[model samples]
Target: MSTTSDPAALSQETEQRPGAKTRVGGLNQHQMQEEDDIETVDYKMVTFSLAGKDYGIDILKIKEIAKFSSFTYVPNAPPFVSGVYNLRGDIISIIDLRVMFNLPAERKPEGSAEDGLILRLDELMIGVVVDSIDKVVGIVSSRIQPPHPIFGDVNIQYISGVVEKDGRLYIILDVDRIFAKGKSTTEEAESLSAVVAPETSAASDNIDELKQQTIPGLDGQSSGKNEEELDLEFIREGLGTFRGFYPDGIADSWLHRRYSEWRAERKKQGLDVQLTGEDDADNFMRTFFSPYSNRFLGEDYVEAVKAVLPEEVSKNISVWNPGCGKGYETYSLATVLRMRYPGHILKIWAGDNDLLSISTAPNLVFGADAVPTLYEPYLVEAKNGYSFSSEIKDAILFEYHDVTHTSTVPDIDIIVARDLMSFLHPKQQASVFNEFSQKTSTGALLIVGQNEHVPESQDWQHVGTSVVNAYRRL
Candidate 1:
C-alpha cells in the first residue's frame, strides 16, 4: 500500500506480510496485547451487591429495575408467592430477592415487603428486597462458565452460569427455570379446594410481612406445593377437547353454544377434570378464544391498520388475508370495503393454515357477541345504527394455505396479517415476512401485530405505531 523505498520500511513490510494475522501482528505489540486482553461481548462480568453481599444476575434477564410498591399479598398462597403488583397494566408477581439469594432475611418492623426494588423477569416478576442495587457493570459473557454440577445440590438450581470479573464472582439467575420449578405440585393441588385459594388482597399483605421476617434461604416452603403442584390431570383433561371439534366440526352456532353450555355443566359436576376424549379440546379452544375473538382493536388500531396502506393507493383495494382465523377481519374488512367502494369490486383472498376451518366453513355469517368490538357489523346491528348489506358477502373468499409451504401464496395488492405472526417464533415470522416481501409488488402494503415485527425488516417503511405496524414494501 505504500510507495516507500526505505530498507527499514521494506523489512517492516516483509515482516508484516498482509494477511489477517500479519495485519493483526503489525499493530503495536503492546496495543495488540491490550486488544487481545479486552473482551467486548464478554467484556467484564457484571458484579453487584444485594443485601451487603455479592450478587450477580445476567443483565439481559433484567427487564426493568423499579422501586417496589404496595402489593396484594396472596393469602394461603404458596410460600414463594411474594405478592402481586400492577405492572403497567398486567398483574405481575414479585419474588422476594432475599429469599432467592440465601442472604440474611429482609428485616422490617411489620409490613415492609411493600418497599423494595422490582426486578422483572421473562414471564414473571420478582420483588427481591436488596439493601440496594449497585451499578450494573459489564462482565464478559464469554467468561461466564457453568459451575460444577454440585451447584445444583445446594438450592442453586436457579444459577445458570457463573462469571468471574475483576477477581470477583457473579451469579447468573435463570428466571425461567426458577419459574418452571415454582409452579404448584399435583397431589396438594388436587386437594386445592381444601387448601383454599389465596385471596389476592391477602397475598399482598403477607408479602410485606414475609419481607420483614423471612429467613435467608427459605427454601423449605410452608405450603401445599412448590410451583409444580399444578393439577396435571385437570390440565390434561382441560386440553383434551382441543384435539377434536365438538359435534363433528360443523361450525354450527347452535353446536358452538351447546358445546360451551355442556362443558360448563360438566365442570360444575367436577367432570371438568376428566379428560374424556378429543371432543373436549374444542371446548377449550372456544373458551380460550371466546374472550378475545370479535374484540375491537380500537380507533387507534384502525388508524394503525390504515397507515400500513400506501397513502396514494386508491381506496377500493385488494387484500390477501393470510391465516384469516375464522374470517373475522375478512368479513369485517369486506363490510367496510363494500361500504366504502359502493360499486368498485374488492377482492379478499382469505386463507388459514388450519384445514378444519376450511372444511367446516361458514362461507358467510360470523358469530356475534364474542370479541364484539372487532366484528363491528354485529355491534352496528345491536346498536340499531346500521343494517347489513347483502352485497358485503360477495367481496370475500376463504381458503386454506400452509404458510410453511409458501408456494400456495398468490400475488396481491395488499396483505393483512393481523396478529398472525404472534403464534410463530421470530425466525419463522422473519422467514414468512421474507416470503411475503418477495410475492408482494413494490409498494404493496403489509399489516402486522402491535407486538410483532418483520426482522431485518427495514425494506418496509415505518409509517405507523408498532401496535399495528403498517408497511410499504420497497
Candidate 2:
C-alpha cells in the first residue's frame, strides 16, 4: 500500500508563490469550532448471591440467569474445564466451583437446561454450578468497599471490593481471577514459555470420573439434584440468537447480514479454514483488513526493517503479525529489519494466512489515509531483497499464517496482531487464543489490540497499549 505521503511533499504541493496570504478570512477555521462536548455515562452494576453468601459481579457480566444441568465432558481438558456440554451447539463448560471454592463434590443434574447458573466471558461459555442462585440486586461505586478480612471464606485475590444496597452487604467477585483458573490458561502459558524459549490435552476423568459416577438411567437419583425432574428440552443457542434483543429488527438485520456475508466470504478467501469466526469476520478482513494492513507495519518500514535486521531474528527470532492483511505488515516489518542490519543475520518470518490478502499485497498501492501518524525512528540502510546490518533488524522473514490453524508457533521475537480480538466471533475467541500461544518462544513479545485479552489462564504479562500491546511471550 502507498500507506503514507511525505509531509514535506504535502507542504511543497500546497506552497504558494513568494508572499501569499497565509490567512483565509478573519478567524482560523480550526479555532472557531469548539471541541465536541459529549458527556460520558457510566452504568451502575447490580449485586446478587450464589448459595447463601452475598456476592456481587457486574450485572452486565451476565448474559442470562440459567439453572444447572449435566454437562458433556470435553476430553483431555483440565479438571477445571469440567467438560463441554451442548447448550444447543454452544459448547458450555461446567466450572466445578465446588472444587474452586473448597466445597464438596457437586452432584450433576440430568437435563438439557440449567439447574444452577450460566456465566459467560466473551466466547468462553461456562456454567457455574452453584448450590443455588439468588435474585439480582443493584449497586453503585459509592455503596461498595474493600472486602472485610473476616469474610475470608472464599480465598480469592481478584476480588475488587464489597458492595451495599439497602442494609445488604455483598462480596463482589474478581472474575478475572475466577476464570483465570481454567486449564487453558496454565497450559497455554507453559506451552508459550516453552515455544518462545524452546518448549511447548484431551483430558480424561471428566465429571464422570472426577465425581466417580456411573451413567444411570433417566430415572436416576442424586443427593440433592434430581434427573428427570426438569424438562430435557433446550433453549437453542443459534448463531443469531444474540440479535433477538434489538427491536425493529434494525440491529438484528444488520448483524444477520454482516455475519451471513462474512460466512460466504470465508469460503472465497480460502484462508486457513481451521481458524473460524462469524461468516462476516472473513468478509470484514477481506475488505477492511487490507486498509489497516498499512498501519500495522506500513510499506516503508516493512521492506526497510527486513533489509537490516540482525541474524538472531532470522535464525531464531520469528516475527508474527496477528492481523496481517495484504502483507503490508509483513513487508513493512521486513523493511524495518533490512534498513537496520545491512550485513548481520537472523531468522525472522512475517505471517498472515489470508491467501487473497497475501496474494494481492505485493501489487497493491497505499494512499495517504492508510498511513500511521508517526514512524519508527530506528532505521538506517537497505539495498536488495533484504540486506541488513543493525543487530536489531537482521533477524526477520515472512510467512502466511492463521493462528487457529496451529497449536504452536515457531520461535520468534515479536508477534504483532492488532484490533482483531474485538471482532472475533464470541464463540471461537478463547480456543483461537491457543494459536497465539503456540506461535511464540519464551521471552518473545505477543502484541495485541487495545481491547483484546490473553486468557487470565495464560501467562501473558501485559506489555503496552500504544497502537497495540506487547505481552512477554512466556
Candidate 3:
C-alpha cells in the first residue's frame, strides 16, 4: 500500500480491506473496536523536522530540549560528530543527525546555535542536532504501521515505524538502534564508537596540556610566570565550566589546599590528577561544602550556629538567606533563631535561583524519621508527613530570585549565605559582598561556608569558632 499524508484516506484504505465494514451510519463490533483502539493514545513523541520531513523520537528517551552553540572541538572524531558541548555541569557529545543521515542541511550563520534534543541513553547523555524542534505529538501506539523503505530518507533499519496524524506522516526513529554498540557493519561500529569514545578519551585529551604543566606541589616555577600561577587554575576552570563553581576570594585558600589533597589521592590510586569531567570536578570539591548542606541541621550544627549569634539585636530581627535550596537550611535556621531570640519578631527573606526548589519550599514535608529531634518543637504533623508549624513557616518568605540580581530585602541582622559565594565569578562575588555590606548593619552576624573566609576587611570582624566560619559586620 502507498503511504499518504491524509490520515482519513489511510483510515478509509484500512476500512476497504477484506472483511472491513464500509457502512457509514451502522458500524460492526469489529469496526467499533478498531476505532476505539485507534482513539486510545498510549505513546507520546517529541516531533521535529529533518531535511523538511517530519520525524519523531519517543518522549521517554528525551531528557530536555535545548538550543546551544560553540561546542568544544574534539580531534579525530567522526564526520557526523558535532563537537562536544557542556550541558550545565556534564560534558555531553553532540551528533549532527542531518550529517549522519547524509541529508541536505540548512547553512546557518556564524555562531548560530542549532535546535537539539538531549537524550538520556542508559548512563550516557547525548545531544543530537536537528533542523527544527516541533511540538510533542501523542498518538496511539497501535496506529503506528511498520516502517517501509519508501517512507524515510534515511536507512530503513534506523526508522522504527511510521504514523500519520493531522495530515502529516511522521517517521519514528529508533535512537537505541542508531547509537547502539557492536553493530554488525564495520562502518556502523566505528560510528557508534565515535559517540561513546568521548566519555573516556575526549575530556582527558582536551586538558592534556594543562595536565603536563601541573607539578606535584602545583608551584608555577616551570614557565617563569608565563604559565598559570598554580596547577589548581585548571581545576578552577573545570569547576567553572562543568559545575559553575569559582574558587576566588574567600575560596582561594580552600582551592589550594584541596588541590594538594586531590593530587595526593589521585597518586595513591595511580589515576590522572586532572579533573577530566563533571564527576571528577564534583569529587574534587566534595569536602568543600559546609556540614549538613541541603539538609536539616542536626543538634551539633544547630548549637554551633547558635553560639555565633550576637548577644544584642533589635526587637524586629531581619535575616537574609540566599541560596536557600528547598528551604531545608532556611527552616533549620528559623528554628535556631527562634530558640536564640524567642521574644523577637523574626523575618527571613529566603531566596534561591532554582524555581522548582523555591516554589515547593513553602509546602515541603518530611517523614517523621527524617526530621531531626531539634525541630520537634516547631513541627506540625501532616497527613503524609510533618511540616513546619505556622510559628516557624509564617516567619519566612521563599522567593525565586537570583542572588546576583538586585533584591528588595530590608536591612538584615544576619546573613546566612553558606557555600554560596564560591560558586560565583570573582566580579560577581565582589558585587554580592558589596551588596551584603550595604544591606547589613554594624554588629550583624554573617555566616559563610566552612572553608570560605570573608574577604579580609576592617569592616568585618571574625567572631566564629573552628566549627562555624562566621563574621560580625563592624
What are the per-residue Cα lDDT tens digits for candidate 2 across 36-132? 2321212234344444576766655665556545666778876656666667678777776644554334344455443445665766666776555
- Model 1 score (lDDT): 0.53
Candidate 1 regions with alpha-carbon error over 4 angstroms: 1-300, 314-316, 340-343, 364-390, 425-428
Per TM-score, the best of the predicted structures is: 3
TM-score of 3: 0.53
The predicted structure with the larger TM-score, 2 or 3, is 3
Q: What range of 10 consecutive residues in model 1 has the weakest lDDT sum? A: 244-253
Write the number of the candidate with greater TM-score, choosing between 1 and 2.
1
Q: Rank by lDDT, descending?
A: 3, 1, 2
Q: TM-score, each model?
A: 0.35, 0.32, 0.53
Instruction: Report the Cα lDDT for residue 23, model 1.
Output: 56
Report lDDT (CA) for all predictions.
0.53, 0.49, 0.83
Tens-place lDDT per residue, model 1, 114-215, is: 434444454556655445566566765667788544342123546777776667666666655555533543443444434333332343455466444543
Using alpha carbons, what is the TM-score of model 1?
Answer: 0.35
Clashing pairs in 3: none
For residue 31, what is the lDDT in candidate 2? 32
Query: Residue 324 deviation, candidate 1, in Å?
Result: 1.1
Worst 10 residues of 2 by lDDT: 227-236
